[model samples]
Every structure is written in C-alpha cells, then in structure tokens.
Target: MNRQDDLVAEGEPEKEFNPGIAARLPRKTVAGGALIRDPAGRILFLEPTYKPTLDIPGGIAEYDESPYDACRREVQEEIGLDREIGALLVVDWVPVLGPWTDALAFIFDGGILDDDQLTLDPTEVRTAQFLTLTEATPRLRPSMTRRLALAQQALTTGHPSYADFGRDS
Candidate 1:
C-alpha cells in the first residue's frame, strides 16, 4: 500500500493545516519622545538635519525597551543629556498609508534643562532652541502642534493625555 493508503488503514486522523498564528496582523511602530522645558517656560525643539520639522528630544524605542527607557536613551544619544524622565505626557497615534503601518508615539515629560547642560550631537541635531507656543506654531506641523498642546495640558493637569492624530477630542 502507498503512504496514503497505509495511513487510512492505520485509523489515524489526518492533520489539518492551521494558519491561526500566521494570520495575526503586525504591530504598529512604537516611538518615544520628550518635551523638555527651560526656566523661561519654553519648550525644547531639536533641529534635525535629516528633516525640516523641528522634533522633540527623543526617538524610536528599541525592542524589549519601555517607552520611558527609550525616551531617556534617545535624549542621551541625541543630545547627551543624561537625566531622568518625568511622567508620560501624551500618546499620539499617527497613521501612515504607505510602506509603514501606524505609529504609537509617547511623549514624556523631561524636566527643565538649564542652558549649560545641553550637549548637542551634530549628526542628528543641528541646533537646539527654546520656543513658546506662539513662536513654535509656524515651525511645527499641524499634528505636532496638537500633540504638543495635549502634552502641555497633561503637564498642567498632572495626568496623561491621548490623541488620535488630532481627530479624537
């Protein structure tokens, strides 16, 4: 008897293909950033050489790293600021329809930094500046403005905030 005929005579049930595990969707990208403040009450903005937009002091989280840890690491790597990150401020869900999926961004509170403490990394950051909301308004993208607004609110209210790319109130 052939292999198929022998199996049928052995009284063993056929093994059905189960594709359950492979059907799961990929997880969204996770990134962490920091909203650092100065004694003048202005927010810190990093001038990234790679992008026109003024970014906060943070970057993407590595696998197995917590959001807070990623924030600290980014700050240290990008600006050489070795400091403790405060409570989480805002979590923004940003969507991209192309090659990448959506992103879950966490903006954490980086306590005030003095002028002398900053050590900028020339490769990632060109220069750093402190700007008020009004001054920063024109520089940031619409989504970034909304996220920053929510982050400032979280700081004032001592609570975390969320936003769905400025869609959800």
Candidate 2:
C-alpha cells in the first residue's frame, strides 16, 4: 500500500455531519477528492503530513460544497495552485464505514501555472511532487494502485474501468 491508503488505514476517517440529509440519512459522512494532474502524462501526488505515504491532493468535502468543488479546493489547499478538474474519474464506496461513505472522484487535466507556488497544508498535506504514472504505480493507495492498473488497460484499449471485473485484493 502506498501513502494515500495509509491515511485511511491509519483510522483517521474524518467524519462530518451532513445536516442537509441528516434526518433522511442519519449517518456521518467522510468525503474527499483526488486531484490527478497529468502534465506531459506525469502525475502529481501529495505526501501527507502525519503519514509516510503519498496521495493525490484532496480531503473531506464540506457539507455545502459539491464534490467537484471540494476536489478543486483540496488541490488548491494542498498545492497552493489553480487547477481545472476535468472528467469524472471514479465513484467508490467504503465497505466498512459506519455511514454511507461514497466517494466521487474527478480526474482533471491540469497545467502548472506556477510550479514555485506549490505548498502543502500543515494540518493535512505535507509535500507535493510530480511523477509519471509508472513511478506512481508503486506509490499509491492499494485501491488506487489497482485502479491505476485498470486505467492503464483503459489507455491501451478503450474500456473505461475493470474495477468490478478483477481478482480480489
């Protein structure tokens, strides 16, 4: 498992009370975004402050914000740069969460306007660097790393995702 998986595995699942649907769906939620910036096909990832692993810059989404907006905010907060989040990437569910933990991720095509302006949030992010997907394959959350494999296959072929048609991890 690379760094991002460590964050979830570290048992620090941050929960927020969604007052919007608290009455209908009465479960605390944990939401976040994953920013994938492929400048020249090289991906950027963040090394978390409290953990020793790397992850795409993102964090828990606020109640009032859309997941897409949360993702962009996360990238800005973690990298201190502006980005354009592109297509919808992945929507996943945490099987073990006490609440309905569904994650919606958007994969944005981003360009570096100012590389020198990158900075990590002290409370959540730590370091930010760009690496090729080949370099990133070995340094991602298990689900993401596995997802990377599927993404590679999709790049070679035209299939979208094999997230459900694979060997169990």
Candidate 3:
C-alpha cells in the first residue's frame, strides 16, 4: 500500500461523515482537488454518481502518486481533460469517514486542455461542466461550499481565510 492507502489510527470510534462535524473530531486521509479553469475563466465541476453534488475535478492521491499527479489524474478521470496544475492554493486537514486516516487537501489552480478531445472515465465521473463562480457557488458540495466561500472572500477582500476539508474539521 502506498501513502494514500495508509491509515493513521484514531483513538476513537469511527464516525459517519455524511453531515460532517468538526467539533474536535480527529482528522483522517489525504485528498486533492483540481481548480480547473477554462480559457474564459470558468471552473470545471462534476456531479458524482455516489453523491450528486457539484465539485472540483479531483480525488484522493494514489499509491506513489504525488499530490500534483493525483490532482491531474482525478481531473482527467472525472472531466475527461488534460490539465496543468499551478501552485498550491490551500492545504488543510480532512477527516476520514468510517476509518482511521488523515486527508490532507491540496487545492491547485489548473489550466485546461482541448475540450473536444476529452474523454471521461465512466468508473469515476458521472457528469461534468464548466461553471462560473456565480453559477458554481450554489451547486457545490457542503465542504466545497465552505472552501468556495473562503476562496471567494480571499479573492475579493484579500483576507487570509480557508476551510478544513476533513470530516472532523
């Protein structure tokens, strides 16, 4: 098993993370998301088959896969597009659901590729689209909602604010 598959035991019972709570919950897993933008500055998002909420095109890092690699891979799988990842935008702790592990979230600014040539992976992606912040803000997942809020605030006001991605946080 690679680092992404490694579980860091929490000295407590596993908690269901559907409706996430961060009140002193132990963090668990490392995951990343691609903040992909089209030439017109539209962000690409997907509606997961398992959870039909709008979200960035990325997922957990794979064995021997760098966080950057994972980000790119997730986008390619979910959005059916190639990407160029930029600097790290955010790094926060994530709480694992039903197990012990830490999810370190790495957000990156990603550049997009030829839209006509993309091919989504059926096993991972359900549906995808490019949306402006005005459109995407209301459709994101709960965690992504928080992150988007923070990111928007930071962009508009230059305040240093961010959200924790873990189920615990």
Candidate 4:
C-alpha cells in the first residue's frame, strides 16, 4: 500500500493539508530599499514628500512582488533610475510600532551613481542628495540609520546581514 494508505491501515488517522488554513495565516508587510552610493561613497537619501524623515529610494512591495523586484521598481519610480539592483545587503525584521505593522525590509545594493542626473518624482520625493553615513544618521529615523550602517558593512565585507528592527541579531 502507498504510504497514505499504509498509515490509515496502521490505525493512524490520515493527515490532510489544508490550503484554507494556510491562507488564513497572519501576514506581515514587506518593504524593499536600494542602497545607492555616489562615486565618493556617500549614500543616497531621498526626502520623501509623504514622510518627515529622510529615506532611501524605496517603498512597500506590491502584492505578490518579490522584494528584489520591488527595490528595482521603487528606485525607478521614486528617483527615475533604472539601474540594476545588486546583492541583497540587509533583511531587517521590524516589530510593529505606532501605526505601522511588523515588516520585513530588504535592502539591495544599487551599485554606484556616477553623475547620472536624478529625476525625482515630485509627488513622492521632494529632493535627493548624497550624504556621508555620519551626515545621514541624524536625518534618518533610528531604525533606518542602523539598517543603512549594516548595509554599508555588508557591502564592504561582501556578505549579507540580518537585523531585528535594524539591530544586528
């Protein structure tokens, strides 16, 4: 007898997979970001019109979209850059805070930007500029500052990093 039939014959109840149960499982929000750097090694930050703090060129992934694809799409949509996204540098599991849900945030390497003029989406990005990590630290939210630092470390070491709410875990 097949394994399933044998199990039943052995007086063991047959176990069945339930798609409906799986479908009803809780889901976390996902966001993707690009770690774009200038020739001087300064990281790029966007002053988003919708948010008070400066942020990287990225946004929430659309339904069913991979984080890598979301990063590329967000870079293009937010800053009008169609550059290739490189290795994933960081994956941060952020806990729920205030109005935000717990989320998985992915940061990908976006190679160097050598004098390519940026065309910021006026509706989304108010301005874009390159800043040294120290200069950026104060402008970014605490979690983002930590995430950016880890991403930079990953880029330098050629390895990925994981974090819990941007703290290395």
**Model 3 over residues 34-125: C-alpha lDDT tens digits?**
76667776777777776667778788887667788888888777766676777666666656555557567777766554455557777766
Instruction: Name the regions of candidate 1 deviating beyond 4 angstroms.
Output: 1-24
Per-candidate TM-scores read: 0.83, 0.62, 0.64, 0.88
Per residue, candidate 2 scores C-alpha lDDT tens digits across 88-151 of: 4444443443444544333333333434567667787766777866787666666666554544
Deviation from native of the Cα of residue 18 in model 3, angstroms:
36
| TM-score, candidate number 4 | 0.88
* Candidate-wise lDDT, in order: 0.86, 0.58, 0.66, 0.91
lDDT of 2 at 148: 48
Q: Which candidate do you rate higher for TM-score, 1 or 4?
A: 4
lDDT of 4 at 71: 89
Better of 2 and 3 by TM-score: 3
Select the stronger candidate by lDDT from 2 and 4. Answer: 4
Off by over 4 Å in 4: 1-19
> Which tens-of-lDDT digit does each residue in 66-132 have in candidate 4?
8888989999999898989999999999998898889999999999999798999999999999999
Summarize candidate 1's per-residue lDDT along 4-105 as a digit string, tens digits. Answer: 797689896546477564447577788889999999879999989988989899988888777888999999998897889988989899989578789988
Worst 10 residues of 2 by lDDT: 160-169
Cα error of candidate 4 at position 113, Å: 0.2
